[model samples]
Target: MFEEHGPPIEFTAAGDTPEEQTTNLKIVRPSPGFDPASELCAEAIIKDADVTVLDFSPQQVTVRFQIDGLWHAGTPMDREMGDYMLATLKQLAGVDYRERRERQTGNFASLYLKKKQKFKLVSQGIQTGERVALYLDYKRPPLDKPEDLGMRASMGKQLRAIVNDTNMGILMSTAVPGEGYTAVWRGMLEATDRLTRDFFVMEHVGKNEPEVINVYPVEYDSAKGENPMTPMKQLMLKEPDVLAFPDIASGKLLDQIVSHSVTHEMPIFTRIPGKHCLDGLLRLVALKPDVKKLTDRMTAVISMRLIRLLCEDCKIGFQPHPQMIHQLGLPQGRVAELFKPMVYQPGMVDENDVEIEPCSNCSGIGYRGRTGLFELLMFNDELRQALVSNPRLDQLSAVAKRHGHVSMQMEGVVMIAGGRTSVEELQRVLKS
Candidate 1:
């Protein structure tokens, strides 16, 4: 006889009763002149002990928090229906939240309770306008979080071997209000475990911590004869509109908010999956002045966008017309006339599909999601000189073209010829 087999074991659910999972938390009720959710959202002051509960009339309660620089209110919640929230906040922030009572006109009235603590988990440091607070609604996976926020001073030293050892320094990103720029820069510093603020700036000259300094106004002193371009004076004086943040200088300010996340190491996500991080790194590399050796050594950054191919299912083969070949400037029949002419509808095909069929992948649109297209251009002495001259983007493009480098638009054209994207689509985004 065969032995009876047992079913696979499943995870044990946490709580046994609904009531055990729910809790009542006291929240600071808003006055008539103030917004209720604002207290929990961006720019709101939240102590570790902050909690939310319902009013006596039985209306559902809601809370808001700043997440990635955006303010959002949570789902409507009933009183005593979110014990998990109460417990989670206590564990994460290390504070107990409860309620208090006061005598009103006749009987006792309940209100949010507040108790002072002798200590806090996070140390109180000198506050700066450079710091931004990013809030999260629901916790995201730690592995997918961004970790870099600010630039490190040591990076200039570390890259010495890759560039001119002397006359090389970092340039920081200017603060853009409400973009979470400060928070991103600070978060990056925290990732490297070198987070600090308001120490003597000169003392940390060779260290990793980045300095936050005010941008000095553009000044030309007639009596002193101080030129703003003087290297020594420039180092000592930043433009008034260009507040220098160390984290942004080192390019760490754009790192992901989540610790140890592999995917979200950059602040933004583009449609192209891996292109976001690669683009950011490329931009940082471009910003450096003395890193000519580094720039020359690297190949182009990789980016991908899906494209559509001619639909073989309904395509009809025919010789390409002379006009089409002439416009393309290919010698007559020099380009192999393999797949001639195809159309989506036999009689009603639009001029857009002069020689291609509607694609099954694109459901007769001749395209799908997006095709991956790549453009690689290496920089050298010529390009660096162009950047140093502070030429407009057009001037730089012209110089790059003279060096036999293919423009980003040309790469897109190659993709277009292959039916990956229409010329019209390329026109919409092909920045000069």
Candidate 2:
């Protein structure tokens, strides 16, 4: 084998080895002293973090973990070791590490604790240095049902009523990306009367979820230029009762769906992305479908956003001033005690002269997990008329308020007052 005065095929190895490689494929040997756990992660960290970040700089790599939408710092790492770790991880994730100036994404899977963990790795260059971020797909528990998604009891009833309707209309579930849009959308699909009614779902081939009981899940080869509509065209030959699919990105498809639902009296369920219920609704309306037809054919929009739950053990309940309550748009005398998180002040010591430890439950972050706040915007005659008369958001919102569509803001206040979450967390989520 010829030694190189040039690059030796860029073979990667762990940073603990200071000696450089002399030939291509020379770093393949793993002996008794090699331990990958130190480079990638520990068993406990794999269970704790929903997202992990390794931000590199000239001097060091700052490690951070995101739990329930909040970032928690991990121990700092040495720069040389961090760079080696990053390069090895990038190669394992199938991303190019040479071009660190450009953004790259790759997928990696690992089996830890007998469960398959899928990670989406994103690495990019920055002005000062480079950074790598990873998201844990399996960290989120399954939102298998309406209650699991944290829907209020009353809102759940209203949604079930919409799903059980015999009349033809469009029922949409909207949430921003990564905000449980799939849960709401698929929950709507699963809530249907699939036993008696022929319910079907269309997704790209091989991307369909596990088959639900009594519901037909179909797929099309998008690589072959066949989509959900392609199979639906042939399926229409049968007496298909209802249809469900994802992605409303295509205007032609939206128009076809609206026209088909109205003309054939078939109900359809789908999802879209936005900040809240009205936000998602208006985005669809902005697509410029027939106002009258959409108003007539659309049944309801169930939209939602997430709110972090305070740690039960560490949350401090305090009396809220009436002025503070009113400032938060809360009704007078409605809330007596409100909860807030306890911040660890530096140099605070216990009776034994030992530094006070942060809350064990939330790791001192004061919030453990998150739950959803939902807005069910049902289109009754008044709301439908309101849409036809004034599709403008303000005019429609005024009418929606009169018809008992509780906005997520109001719902969040309820959650805050109930001690389920804190005012700070509520503000952060709503502002987001």
Candidate 3:
């Protein structure tokens, strides 16, 4: 897949330039006549952060950025400038500028760094003032294959086989929001032969529409008393060979879709929110209340999470720690290589009494990009029989393990052993 699609594009800050690092820095503010709010927005984009939050209060406003799954404090502003910033963003999003006391939501698009970017803005009234959240939809490179999604080669091959199966079944791909679920679904769609088969997708937000795949936008109309299932019914009439629902649906509509997938021998792909494969499956069965039917038509359940990949330019190699090795159940006397981000503390001095500098490659962040940790549960006859009777999550997990299933934790350990990531990173991501 990497050979066919080339390498994944590396994400970079908008105004980032290759230059020498210097201790002297300057803070450049906008001119008196220029808009400070617009400048701040542009700066956020240049930082390449996914989400930004503005906490408004009568005294002042607090800013924060969500970068690499962690939040960092940003520059704060006075009350006057904060109010102006909120008003400017509301105007840009097409929300009612006069109605700041009520909750409102809107979206806008603009060209940033020569790329068209979209953002979702949401605001709600608070005790002291209004709180605003901004979500940036940065454009990502095309994920043309399963391996490109950070899946192990063997797991990717298994997933491809399930996707290509002729028999009718249900394959549930589970992940939290903003954790690469959509990208994985799109890659699975790309693997199918679209020319010979009909493909359809149902989603509320339409983004990154793949070629040769039909998309049906689902929206609700309160004034007209419209039903949300109308669109699903319309798409079902098309007799699609493969149907995908990016979000979980409820009520009789879900039953109809599941029934169709089984009765017509069509493979259906759906997303559920859960941390593990069995948990996702149990949730789906609870919604539909047809355990037999669901288990009978289930082909596989895949659960995944994203972890930061170690920066190759400056990652430091070390021998595995005794505690880490014992936790991973590695055999004693077997040498293993591990890598971690080199951390620098304050007030460190060299032999010449000069302060030490951070690594330029990772900017002291230790990691530069992200990869995925996946757990796949394929339903064989034994597993299906076990699930037919209601079982607890631990029991089901034990059954899967008995069948030689590799979990996300195990996958993370393997990546650590291979020097793809660090133990600290794995613990941070998997932390409750």
Candidate 4:
């Protein structure tokens, strides 16, 4: 996967066969006066969009823009114009435009908004046609601190408590695909008070990992049928105080880690792919097959999701109805007005025969930046005992409430009530 990759690329419409999806999609050839550079710039849209996609199906070619972790469809083009556009993008990125059979990835730099930005181009041949995806690496700001990444103040305190604790336990961070798992986990590791403790990171042979000060990395080549347990035995001679397994995912090896290393006052930090923290815990159990080994030493499991922020310059406010608030499960009489994006109309002109201009700040997209929604499932004595007995979603949800744990949706409602985001946007990101 590419660095800061966008969401998954869809070749056809959801729940529709390929033949059915292209029934209404028509490609009108002979695009009049199509200039490759101008067309590429137009599809790239404003400063809000980070990545632009040009996907060619048999029937037509579709353009997509990545905004706030979601993909929005752009203007469609005919096959002839699409071919020219693809070649233009490849030539600009220094990739061979003529070689269409194999996969290719390259980068190109451009001047936009008085900034020199670099873009990555990836072109892969499909069964029907070619699909090219571009990424603007700089658009994604560096989120080193939890507060800057939309983490709640109280939650940040809780995470710091766990990170600074002298006890031995397990710390894990969970997120779905393309939901900033690597960034969140790295931020957690950075938050650690690792100066006094000897921290060692067990990672795969080849991975683009960030270099954290005072933390050393030991590699294991999985391509050669290697595992992390063998390297752990070798590294144990130095007597590491904290072990961070960023990419060692074998359950059997993890069982060895917890059984041998945990009681010696060495805490382990790991990551897993899941929809939420509880989901991650369940997945860990499934991987290890021994619930007691994980529950006894669990410290906390944190999860996160990304949501778009409304542009203050162009966001429109309107009174909310009672039903709308009730449907979103917001507290009654709490929210007065809601915010939404201002879409550009086809003929939005003024009465003075002058065209109405969209907002220049946001380029009429009505959104400028994004913030993350976070949730934490911190373990305590009662919660761990309960999990050991019954490890199920419904049971854990009921028990977690008694422990004063806040869920991701409940945390998102604070943003909706503050008018920083809208109900529709929250629902869209959660459901997506």
| Candidate whose lDDT is highest | 4
Q: Candidate 1 regions off by >4 Å? A: 1-333, 336-361, 416-432
lDDT of 3 by residue, 248-345 (tens): 66635567667878777888887777766887777776676566776788888888788888888778998887887989856655746779887555
Give TM per candidate. Answer: 0.30, 0.79, 0.73, 0.83
C-alpha lDDT of residue 82 in model 2: 76
How far is each candidate from the true structure, as Cα RMSD in Å?
18.7, 7.7, 9.1, 9.5
lDDT of candidate 1 over 153-256, digit per residue (tens)? 34323322222211112212222223333333332222221122111111112334333332122333334643222232343342111112232233132221
Location of the lowest summed lDDT over 10 successive residues in candidate 3: 20-29
Q: Give me the candidate number with maximum TM-score.
A: 4
Tell me how candidate 2 scores on lDDT: 0.73
Model 3 segments beyond 4 Å from truth? 1-46, 56-61, 75-125, 129-137, 202-239, 245-248, 251-258, 331-335, 343-353, 358-363
Error of 3 at 208 (Å): 10
Candidate 2 lDDT tens digits, 1-432 = 112221112223322233432221133223211133133444224435777888889999888888876677776868876776676566545567676889998765555555666667798899879878877667556576676778877778777788988784898889878877776776677667788888877777777565667778777886998766788777888778888877776656788788878778989987788878788878887777676777788888888788888889889999999888987888888678999987666577879999987776766777777888888887888777776677677888888898777888888888888899887787888788
- Model 3: colliding residue pairs: none
Off by over 4 Å in 2: 1-47, 80-130, 134-141, 205-213, 220-228, 329-331, 350-354
For all candidates in order, the CA lDDT equals 0.31, 0.73, 0.70, 0.74
Overlapping backbone residue pairs in candidate 4 total 0
